[model samples]
Structure formats: C-alpha cells, structure tokens
Target: MAKAYRKDEFEFFQNQVGKIDQRVKSYLEVAGFEKWTWVYAPVNRGRMMTSNLAECINGKLKQARELLIIEFLEEVSASSTHIYSIYDEGKKYIVCLDRSPFSCGRFQLDEITCERAITVLKNKHVVDMKPYCSEYYYPEILRKTYDQSMFPMPYKKEWIVPQEVIDEVVLPPKYKRQPGRPKKNRHKK
Candidate 1:
C-alpha cells in the first residue's frame, strides 16, 4: 500500500488486504488506508522497513563499537586505509562507466545530486573523489563548517549590549486555563 502511487494500484492493495485476512480488513476499517500509505506521511521513509541494514552494519562493526572512542576512530581509519586518491599512487583517474560506486553506502547522503555529480565527474575523466570525503561526503562544505568558530559565553565585563535592543520591554503571552482536569497523556485519536 505504501509503494502504491497510483489510485488503481492503491485500491488493488486495499482489496487484496481483505482477501488475505478478514481481521486485517477490520483493522484497516478501524485505522484507515492512509495509515499504510507512506507517501501521505510527513517524512519520506525510503523503501527499507526493517533493521536488517543496521544489523548488517552492526555485524561488521561488532568489535569496533566495543572499543574506546579513540580506538574506534583508529579502527575506522585503518579499515579505510585502502581508500585513497589516484593521485596518491601517481595514477590518473579512470572514467569507466562500469566502475560505478553504486550501493557502496556512500551515495545515500545526497542521493540524486551526489549520484548525478559523481556520474558527471566520472564521464568527464575527472579525479576519483570517492575517498577523502567526510560528514555528508562533501569536503568543501565540511571544511567550511569547521572553519567557523562556535562562540561560547563571554564574561559579563566583556559583553557588549545595544541600549535600544535591551531597553525594549516584552510581555509574556496571556492565556485562560481550561476548566476540566488535565489528562496525563495525549492519546492518539
């Protein structure tokens, strides 16, 4: 039902639900078909519906996560030691169409844009930029992010305040309290 983008396909799934299990039809009647429609949800949770991917990653990093943060970082760095720029080895980039890094788990960050950029760069016989990428796999953006200083709270004597900005008075919002006893938890309707 979630993958059903068309009306007919959606209806077909709805009808099929009743055929599979009578109890499911009753549940659907109570919950509504919109509940099963992923497209209607606020967030687009792509195709995956299980924790199999996480389990696979956890299986790979089973020993690493058990180590200390510094050790973990070292393990990660050691694991990707083989990943390097072609220039490092005194070699030029190869623009082979068959050398796509699809399903490499690196393209999931900025799906369409990154994939398109990679493909375009590969076609143009540019450098292999797969390695040396961090934090969303965009080095320029990552560098720019680290370049800025996170300003911490300064001493009161060092603080500078505009008189007009501080002088302006603001009133707290006014509200009337409800008469009924408040419910503890908000139950979904």
Candidate 2:
C-alpha cells in the first residue's frame, strides 16, 4: 500500500483482498480504496505523496525535537522565519477590467489578489475589487468544496464490476524500428 498504486494493480489487490475477509473489505471501502492517492488531499500536505517527507522532516527536526519544548519551538520558528520575506521583485502586471482573465506571474493564488493588481487598481482609483476577480476564487466556492458530503463506498462483495471491463485485454504499444541510422550527436532545434 506504501507504493504508488496503478489502477489495474490496485483493482487486482482489491479483488484478492475481497476473497479474504468481508469485514476488512468493508473497512477499505470506507477508506476510499480506489481513490486513496496521496495527491487527493493536498491542503498543507507539502505535496508529500510518500513517507520521504516525514523522513526529511524527521532528519531536520531530530535535534530540535530533543531540546526543551520552548527551545524547540523557538528553533522551529527561527527556521521558518525566512518564509515571511517576499522575493518577488521587478515583476509587472497588466490589470484591465476589459481583460476576461488578468494574470501576474509572481502570485500563484491569483493575479487580482496579488500586490501588483492592488497597485494597479489604486493607481486607476478603482474601489471594490470583488468584481475584478473570477467567481471561482470566491469564498463561497471554497466553502462549498468543504461542505460537500462524500458517502462511503460499499463492501467489495457489493461493488459493481462489469464482466467486459474485468476481462478486458490490454497490450503494450507496438515497437517500430526507424529506417534512418541512429545519430551519435544530439540535434539542436
């Protein structure tokens, strides 16, 4: 389960596990057996798709964790202090109401919410920025995303698997030998 699971392999594992215990299958069903990829929930997860992140953090914080609680907290705070500094410098933005989607390279969150957009708006004397940003970035959208309910899946015995899909044949791509002789030197565009 620690390894990155391919869809076909995961399905095979599910089928094998299904033959073992129904209770275990039920538990896995509730835990998103098919959709358990690490990238599914990326909020503040540091893009960690494996235990490598924990290993790296453990290594860096090992000495710090051994220190007194206050000292450890201070050390952690000191280590992350640099994140408060903004490195975006000499970047430009073209802010316009007519432009359907305004974009600035510096900000990942959104262009309209970035400092450059604010500066442009201030220069143009435009107030109330809610109209400038897309509705997709609105607070309501985030709230809705969090509010949705995802029901647990049924047990493996109850799972619906079509016979055609389960027995489908998959083949590797056909290899073709090029007519031209292989070049030793790399070609430049």
Show where candidate 1 strays beyond 4 Å: 1-137, 186-189
Total backbone collisions, model 2 = 0
Lowest-scoring 10 consecutive residues by lDDT in candidate 2?
44-53
lDDT of 1 by residue, 1-189 (tens): 765533455668878988999898788668865567643443434322222333434444679988999999887676543222233134333211222222322232222223443655665666966442324547676688799789889998888999997899998899889999987997889
Q: lDDT tens string, model 2, 62-140? A: 7898899999988777654211222346533343233312233222223235565566666668787776565666788
Question: Highest lDDT: which candidate?
Answer: 2
lDDT of every predicted structure (CA atoms): 0.51, 0.52
**Judged by TM-score, which candidate is best?**
2
Mark the regions of model 2 whose C-alpha exceeds 4 Å error after superposition: 1-92, 98-114, 122-127, 169-189
